[model samples]
Target: MQTPPDRRSFLKTTTAAAAGAALTSTIARSANAAGSDEIRFVLVGCGGRGTGAAAQIFNTKGNVKLVAVADAFAANAERALKSLSRGENESKVDVPPEQVFAGLDAYKAAIDVDADLVIIATPPGYKPQQFEYAVNKGRHIFMEKPVATDAAGVRRVLASVEESKKKELMVAIGLQRRHEPTYMETIARIHDGAIGDVISQQVYWNGGGIWYRNRTADQTEMAFQTNNWYHFNWVCGDQICEQHIHNLDVGCWVKGMYPVECNGMGGREQRMGGDASKSQIFDHTFCEYTFPDGTKMFSQGRHLAGGWNHVGEHVQGTKGTANPGGWIKGEKDWEFSGKKVNGHQQEQHDLIEALMRGEIYNEGEYGAHSTFTAILGREACYSGKVVKWDELLETGTELAPGIDDFTIDSEVPVSARPDENGLYPVPVPGKHNPFA
Candidate 1:
């Protein structure tokens, strides 16, 4: 059986090859060839988001089709294919059973197909590695965010961003809010001083809890954890990175820079006292981020039910306060009264448009920075210490070590065996070093 390419080779080849510029130009010409401008795509990580992205790509203005599908499980890939085949853009779904791949190495099989683009919607932990491989192969990509789950992964993504630019690959991150017309218009005005000198900001994703994947007795530890990845810190990067990144990205966007430092607190309160394997991650986090100019941004993310459900970004400036969702109050009181497009679908539309125009819209760098911002908040909450931007970026912490070599029988990187009371060990602030 064939295995995924080793990480060393992937990194070495990507670093050694300096043909990004030329390869990008070649891809542009090939994609835009007269009367043959068909954009073929392979969907990696056949989850709801992945399949949705495939369908959205077909919705774009082009002859786009889903040529292949890949997932960690065969069942998931089949479900995704079936879902796409029955969608409004069913004509674009062309992945035969043989073309649908499953297993840890399934992404390589999908990427190997003759396709113009690849959509990576896997768990954030797997993104950096998969993204590097796709870039090395000179493929245009549409990857979901948060782009990575850790500082180490962020480093790899940042490097890929530069390489993609050199090769001119059109890479778009799943920070879909960036494509929302309301947000775009509002932020444009904020940048134009409609919000005056930004003084403070607040971002949130506090909402109800997420679903839990019950572990089957027949499954291995690895299978169980991978199935319930969102609960695992190594795989999901915790709730802060997984879901709250959307709000955090908006905060950074409003400030026009990443945070300089972060300090926060979090704990697994509501979803606790369960089987160790089932409830390991926290359900709530509150972070205070400081930008370079001493600007402060208060961020809060929680999954507890019926407390408060605010999921937007608000920036307060010297003159006015602006909501990135298309509203402003105080000196420049205005509300977004324009038409709204589905930002989720708009992200794909913009990406395909850039491809057709031969323009490289690589969001890799910004994606990494935003992802790391979440990591900083997580590390702060986990370690009970203030984490500086530079130090966290330089940490050798590798969440989900040996993820590149995962197999059905592989051991789970985090061992969350239940205690006598069937409870898991949650992060205790000031008890252990999370960054270590």
Candidate 2:
């Protein structure tokens, strides 16, 4: 494995002086206030993952406080706040009802509050906009994975990454596997030649099914889709980008490069009782990705019940084989025997510690690129044609145009109404124009 480049070397000389001065000031303040000063943060999107991330932050060593919270729904924000205001986290949380915001634009209010960090766990569709806002505010960020739902959104995130680096802000994405001790040890060895020259890989996120929320009689089309985001393409990007991205990301990490081309097949096999009206996303996908080095990665992602279930990655190398999560199977086999840690919790710990040390590390670039990789596979499966990284990224359709101005009463980009047969339109291979 090649030695990782020093992050400082990539700093722009034009901004080097300013960045250096900022870093020095930050280091001194952080070092002096380590355990004394409060590190306040705001939460945007009070869903399950958002709540969990807040809990982890409270567990970190420091004087951290949850200053504000926001969600598309008021109930979600309230519920998350109630959950956090229990046991050990209760004292650390300072959010009052006034600071708990709701509605599509609520994130702006929460982010506007005085805070050192912002945690974004919104649906993938909302991430790019929210992330750009956080960076503009000059707040550190800890955002969830699959940074975007479409190539357009990925482009937006990539742009924000540059601004964040210029400001020397610390940005951590929720690809927690990179922070897991076991995965770290195993991948380090792979890069060190334990799994010499990875040739092929197999990754899977095959699972049973996901939760579905029935549209209530009083709910608007936008409300209904937001409630059941997992079933929508505009918001969720299907299961491939939503859930299967982790495994695909591991494949890319082992190869140290993104796939150049991909083709695949997928459809809504057993989803919503085979009714397309209820869901616009595919339930199963099989993607064949070709890396720039000509290596292939066979990817599988399924949501059908009673099928084989798997959620890991495997790699084949010239000199050996490896399960990048922890083990190598050739040229002196080895296993990770380190203390197992919860990646979700560990990631928070790492971010907070690095902030105290004033060390800036931005994961946004790879996060956006890996997300686009998943989008590439999804497009291939949807179009039933080979898709190249550059072409799709340059011409792919935006999943939600004018997303920055969305409101609760705004019409959704994808219709929720059913056809005469009570079926929603599902993407048909060979007919879907991914770049349209």
Candidate 3:
């Protein structure tokens, strides 16, 4: 398809605008002082990310225990259970054969278990409602990133955020970049203006592509979307929210605030009409985020074949620029900007300790803002124009396909042709782009 003029210009201006928007936002963190110990956990999603996170949480000390498991697929739940450490500590798990749940309401099944904490590791589409359920039941939570696929879902998460704080529930989102010590130290320095007045930053997460392959004849869009939830817009919120959200979160962390507006571009670069099931989400997205203090974040993410060696953050100022790992370069030349950096292990362990010590802790509001920062940039890239964070914050577009019944016919198409005219809704802002 020929490049549309509107789209072309949108891409061009976005690049220029990014020259000054770096490190304008940092994730707001809340870690209450240590209190009395004892916290149990229930994992809702059991895919690789979920299981891997479970492992990290396990390594955390101070009265933390995994108790239950739940997934839409039986195999997923079983996989999570099997991968966990088996000992007297893990032996008290509430998930036996009868306790493991598989179904649309698997989260409820897991939440119904006798546990004090829950992990919403399922697809983002279900995160809001599941989180609400967990919060209502009064449980501390450790949810994966991309809080919700759409604005309303975010609203739901925000609602839960309020209640969880009221109950003093310990809620942590799995934006592990916050846990990566190298980035943390670098960000602290940037905030301290070690590089002088911050000017801009460039963050990229590009690769040859991730799990987007053809589905067999036996697989339907519904089945494929549910199983490969990370690739579905309604489920994972695209690469921007799923993968790039990390970079966005880093931007938020470095800037010490949230972006006010964003402009971007995204499309199905490699997989257009091949098959709806193979890949239904945008493969690449480039966005310019303008934060409250006029800092810029040149955020970019791509899954194209043979792309750049990626996955890092760079904060720039009048003095220097550095990757999250403390690699800094400027007129003074490259200098390792080592600071106090900690990984997910330490972060989770600290949170658990805080919980045990009865310290105030909550990942609700701060995590939501960071998650939306990524989502807003995504909406910009999707629509080929700037979008206000306010609009995104109140957006009601829902990608959550609440399918009551799953069958081949009930599947949502993931890919399509733009027709002979090469036309499709490309996430334009403010006019109710109803293409979802």
Query: What lDDT score is found at residue 374 in candidate 2?
Result: 94
Could you tell me the TM-score of candidate 1? 0.90
Candidate 1's residue-wise lDDT over 1-436, tens digit each? 0111232432332221211221234344354424567788899998889988888887889778888999989999999888888857788877787899999788998998888799999988789889999988888888999888777788888888788877778778888887887887787688778868999999999998898888788998777777887887777888999999999988887777667788999887677444354777888899999887788999999998878898988889998888889898767588998999998988888778667756555667667877888988998998788888887788736767777898878876653544667555567888747556
Give each model's clash number.
3, 4, 32
Against the correct fold, how does model 3 do in TM-score? 0.80
Across residues 1-436, which tens digit of lDDT does each residue of candidate 2 receive?
0111122332221111211122333532232223557788999999999999999999999678999999999999999999999997889999877999999899999999888899999999989999999989888889998899988899899899898888878778888887787877787788788978899999999999899999899888788888888888888888988889999888887777778789999987798888777889888999999987688999999999999999999999999999988989997999999998898998888788777666766777777877888999999999999998888888888878999999988988853345678676678999999887
Native-structure RMSD, model 2: 4.7
lDDT of 3 by residue, 298-356 (tens): 98888888667688777878887777666556554444544554455655675565555
Order of models, best lDDT first? 2, 1, 3
Best by TM-score: 2
| Root-mean-square deviation per candidate | 6.7, 4.7, 8.6
Write down the lDDT of every candidate, Cα atoms only.
Answer: 0.79, 0.83, 0.66
